[model samples]
Target chain A: MKLHVHIKKKISEFSLAVDLEMTDGLLSLLGPSGCGKTMTLKCIAGIENPDEGFIKLGDRVLFDSRKKICLPPQKRRVGYMFQDYALFPHMTVRQNVLAGMGRRPDPASADPFLERFRIADLHDRLPEELSGGQKQRVAMARIAAQDPDVILMDEPFSAMDTMLKWELEQEMLETLSEAEKPVLFVSHDLDEVYRMGGNICCMKDGKTGNIISNEEFFEDLKNGNSELLPGWRILPPER
Target chain B: MNDMVNFLSGLDWSPLFISLKTGVVATVISFFLGIFAARKVVKASPGVRAVADGILTLPMVLPPTVAGFFLLLIFSARRPLGSALYTSFGIKVVQTWLGCIIAATVIAFPLMYRNARAAFEQVDVNLVYAARTLGMSETRIFWRVIMPCAAPGIVSGTILTFARALGEYGATAMLAGNIPGKTGTISQKIAMVIQNGDYRTAGFWVAVILIIAFLIILLMNVVTARHMKNIHRY
Candidate 1:
């Protein structure tokens, strides 16, 4: 599956104009904060409306400005894992995970993720009751349960300790890898990016300036094509 | 003095019952309307919000006599509503206890709305967002997330409305009139007793009212204190 997006939005002073196409698997929007990375993902998820842009995940035109076609976030079927995970505190882990289940709620799609994420035992626990790692797992299961066409993550592990982050990072990659659809994840850690294993898109000044393969990503960073963009970053390198 | 004592002592309690009947009904009615109006304001478009906020507060700011006049305008026999209530429904407002209730509700409504709106506004809308993301519809999210969190606010507004209704004077006297044992309220009762140079009777009723209002206020304070705690935690 492929998702195409061309978004232009002015957020206060800096304007973001993002035009990028991804052909399935995992695509990383590698950028620091305020680099328009999150907005690009939000445009695809139908959260924030861009000034002028269109996004299409296959035949579904999620957002088309000229036609004034804008599907709300609920209808987009693009699972978003907010930087904080945005899990519902009032709901038990099971209920949160169940949110993304099959429309018919066939146990077939959900049971496996719950079991895989190892949160099957924490089903009754509220979000506050769960540990940081458990919350991260529940987020994964919530996203996995829905059978979304695309999963979008914004700094998924930003709040956790490095160990917890690394631990959840592996779990996320494993679960997201199981689905056949595309996953567009955002991250600042160069190492986590390397661990996640995807084509990297380095964003700068509201534009995505580079889309380099893994080898090229590292080489450009070491050799300094990475320097062209100010505030450019190298995510935590893979161990 | 003995006759006055007997008249005050055996004052038929049915008027007290009727007064309570009006106070309670008025308070309940205003509470519901106020909550609805406040929720609408908080959730409304900017233009609608300004209009609703202003309209809701009119009862609070307008003279209770003005409210009586407006109610008279709205429900007088010559007016459409008055004509309908009198002719079509055979209902009456002038010198009627229900008219007192209507008058009381209008005056107390803004307190209910303002308090409830503050409570609702304090709620973190992110919780609502999180609920929606869990695939729950907006209504479900509201019932499950918004209302439970706003309960204390609702309760506080209810108590304030009840207290306001209990003390309502100008609109109740102006619209419903002080027909003893009929449209007359506790306030009217106290005023009439005092006018007749019945200080002992007035003092007795005043003491009794103080006890009752004090208890109610204490209960209201307890609820509000609990609500404040909830606001801090939630």
Candidate 2:
């Protein structure tokens, strides 16, 4: 499935103008904080409205400013995992997964998702009881349950410790490969983006750069091409 | 001790019951309406929200008697709404128990609305976005996520509303009047007894008020403390 997005929004700090397209693999949006990486994902997911824009996913017009059409997040068929995981504090892991399916208390349906994410044993536990990594698993399971056309994850590992982040990153890479859909992963860390190893869309000052292959992205970084990525400065050699 | 017992036996307890019934009915009505209003106002456009917030909170800021006067203007039997109700439904609010409920609800509703609004504002907005992305309907998200997160403030709001309703006097006195068995409340009873130079009876009523207020505050603290622990767990 293909996803196309061209949106413009006025933020208090800057005017966001994004134009991008993706299909059938993870496309990492790399940028420093406040560079509209999250805002672009929000626009595609229909969480935030754009002043004028068009977003199409697999021939479905999610948003078209000229047509005055804007799908609500519920109708966008786009799964989102927040930076904080955003697990419902009051619900158990099972309920959070079931919520994605929009089904009743049917353990049969929810069990597969929990099992898939390896969180089946923690089904009855509330989000507060889960470790950060477990919560990420539950969030992933919830998204997988929805089976949306596109998945948008905003800095999913930002809250985890470095050790846990590495562990989760390995698991996430496996999951994304199997997802086989347009996945927009937002992250500010160059190392994390490099590890993700996909098309990199660099953003700076609310504007998106060219979509470069992972090899080219790392190549440019290694060459100290800070012009392509803002908020990047090669460290001085040790004294 | 005997004199105290005799005085208790002679006490007219109708005022206590009436006040409690009024408080409960008003509080129940306010609880739903307040939450509903808070939700609406929270989702409304900024300009509309500002104006709506001001109007909703006006009764809490205004004098109770002034609020009662406005209630009188709307439901005074001579007014259009009051006349229609009287003619079509045979309902009379002025000088009736209904007057007591309306006055109390008007005076106390803001507490519920304000508290609920503040709580709703404090909710992590990303949770709502997450729910929406999960394909949950708006209603489901509201009930499942927003309500639970805002429960502590709502609980406190409910207790404050009930207490304020129970202690409502000026508006009740102005609209419902001190009808001995119909609309008379504890505060009006205490006032009437004290004005008649019955210091002992008035003091007893004062003690009852103090006890009820204390119990309500205690209940609030217990609930909030438990809620705080739950929040910290998150």
Candidate 3:
């Protein structure tokens, strides 16, 4: 699927003007904190409105300022995995997954994602009972059950330990690879962006700077030319 | 010991019942209205929120007598609202059971509203956004997510509201009046007994009131503890 976004929003002391387009792949929007990466995802998810812009995903007009067409988040059908996971603490794992499928969701429909995310045994447990990794799995399971047109992840693993982060990343890659939908992952960590294995859109000062392939990103690191973009840093590869 | 026994045996129990009935009814009305108003005020703009909060909380901050004065101006038989109600529907506000409920609800509503508002504000906004993106409707999110998460604060608000309504005296005296076996509440009864120099009867009622208040507060704490257990421990 194709995703196109050109939006401008002026927040307090920071102006966001982003214009980018991408085809099907895990596109990472790498930026520092408060650099509008999450805001861009929020705009696409319809959580925040842009002062002026148009966003279209595979012929669906999600938002268009000139046309004055802005669909609410519920109508957008975009699966957004929040940074903190945002799981309903009151709901069990099964109920949280089914909550995404609207009322009267077939219980059988959530089972597949539950099993895929390795949360089948924890279905009866509340989010409060789960670990950070387990909660992330439940969040993904909820999104997978929704079966949206695209997925947006905002700092999905920022709170995890090193070992759990790596493991979940591998598991996430396996799950997302089979889905075949455009996934926009936002992160402030360069190592994470590289490990996710997709196109990289380096963002700075609320604007996307360069769109580079994963191979090119590695090549830049190998050639010691990784300092080309601001707010992009290279760290040692994971053990 | 004989006087205490005599007071208990011949106690005018109507005042205790009247006070409880008024408290329960007022608490019920204030519960829903306070939650609704708190939700609205939380979503309003800064300026509008300030104005609305001030107006809603005025009755609580002012002396009950001042609040009674406003109630009188609005519900007095000569006033348009009171005249319309009295002439059209034959519903009287002054010196009526309904007046007790109205007075108690007005005096107790701000406790519920302020507590609920603070609780709603503490909820992580991202949870609401996530629910919306998951295709959950606004109403569903509020009832399923917001309300359950804010249960502890709401419970506290309800307890305070019931306590305040149960003990309401000055406003109730002005609006409902202290008619024995009718509008007289435990607080009014205590005042009347003291005025007649019946210290034994007044002291007996005071002990009963203390016991009831303690029991309710203990019950609420137990309920709140259970609810708190369901919340995530960080």
Candidate 4:
């Protein structure tokens, strides 16, 4: 399936303009904070509105400014992993996992997701009781339960420490690759882009300044000249 | 025999039972109305907010007797709505069990509105957005997530309302009057017994009500503690 987005909006604080034609695989939107990365992701997920845009998920015209067609988030098939994971504090992990599924409580799908996350034992625990990693696992399970066409994650790994971030990053890559689905994940970390990646778009001034395949992205970074980059705050050690 | 005599004599059994029933029913009705009013007020435009804010806070400021006069006017046969509710419906609110409830509800509205409003506001806007993203309809989100998360605040608000209803005196006495078998509540009973110089009976029931009120306040404190504990850990 192919997904394309060309959106423009003028808000009070800032404005956003992005154009992307995407297919199946993880595509990390790399940008510094306040670059409107999250907002762009929200627009694609149908959580926010863009002033003008054309967004097509495969043959489905989700949004087209000229035609003035916009789909709300619910109608759009999008799996979102929020920054805090946003697990319902009141619901047990099991209940949270089963939230998207309708009435009468289906255990058939829930059991496998709990097993996949290795959170079967944590089914009874609330979000507060779980560690950061555990919460992410539950969040992932919730997304899997939703079973959307495109998975959109905004800073999902930022809450973890370095070692844990790397470990989780690896797991996310392996998982997404096996699924082979279109994804748009946002992060400020370069190494994370390197680890869990397909294509990279470095954003600046509300637009992507650089778009390249993974090999070219890593080689360009290895050359140690970041002026070609959009908004790279950290430079790697010499050589 | 003396202990049994004291135990039996100590109870103003009728008023005690009436007060409990009145307090519960009043709190429940007002809690629902308060939630509805507060939600309506919050959704109203800024201009409407000021008007509703003033109107909502008005019942609290006026003396209970003044408020009673207002209700008197409200339920008076002159008014079309009041006549319909009382005459056509066979629902006699003046000097009846329902009038006591109506009085208590008016006083309890502010507590319910303030608490329920604040509880509902504490819900993270982001979480609600997330729920919408998950394909959950607005109604489902409210009952499933919003209400459950705000349960502690709702419970605290309910306790306050119950306490307020239990202690209601001025409006109830002025409006419903001291009909001992039907309309006389704990507070009205206390006022009547004192007037009659039945210090023994008045003092006895006063002590019972004081204990009940104190325990309710204490239970409210416990609810506050539990709410804090549950709210903070997340």
Which candidate wins on TM-score?
A: 3
Instruction: Supply candidate 4's per-residue lDDT for A31.
Output: 81
Give the least accurate 10-residue stretch of model 1 chain A, judged by summed lDDT. Answer: A227-236
Sorted into a CAPRI-style docking class, model 4 comes out as: medium
Per-residue CA lDDT of candidate 2, range B135-203, in tens?
Answer: 888888888899999998999999999999999999999989999999999999999989999898889
Clashing pairs in 1: A100-A145, A100-A146, A189-A235, A189-A236, A190-A235, A190-A236, A191-A235, A191-A236, A191-A237
Model 3 chain B is weakest, by summed lDDT over 10 consecutive residues, at B223-232
Q: Write the per-residue lDDT of candidate 3 for residues A112-179, one digit (tens) a residue.
A: 88898999999899988999999999999999999899999999999999999999999999888888
Each prediction's Cα lDDT score? 0.79, 0.91, 0.91, 0.83
lDDT of 4 by residue, A57-153 (tens): 8888888889989888778878888999888988899988988665656766688889987899999899988999999999888888878888889
Rank candidates by lDDT, best first.
2, 3, 4, 1
> Cα lDDT for residue A175, model 4?
74
DockQ score of the complex predicted as candidate 2: 0.80
Q: Over the stretch B67-95, how does candidate 3's per-residue lDDT look in tens digits?
A: 99999999999999999999999999999
Better of 3 and 4 by TM-score: 3
lDDT of 1 by residue, B1-234 (tens): 888788767776655766688879988898778878887899899998988799889889998999999998998888898999898789999888878899989998898989989989988765565454445667666776788778878887788788788878888888898988788787778898899998866786677678768987898889878645525463
Ranking by DockQ: 3, 2, 4, 1
Q: Could you tell me every candidate's TM-score relative to the true structure?
A: 0.81, 0.94, 0.95, 0.90
Q: Can you give the lDDT of residue A36 in candidate 1?
A: 86
DockQ of each: 0.30, 0.80, 0.90, 0.61
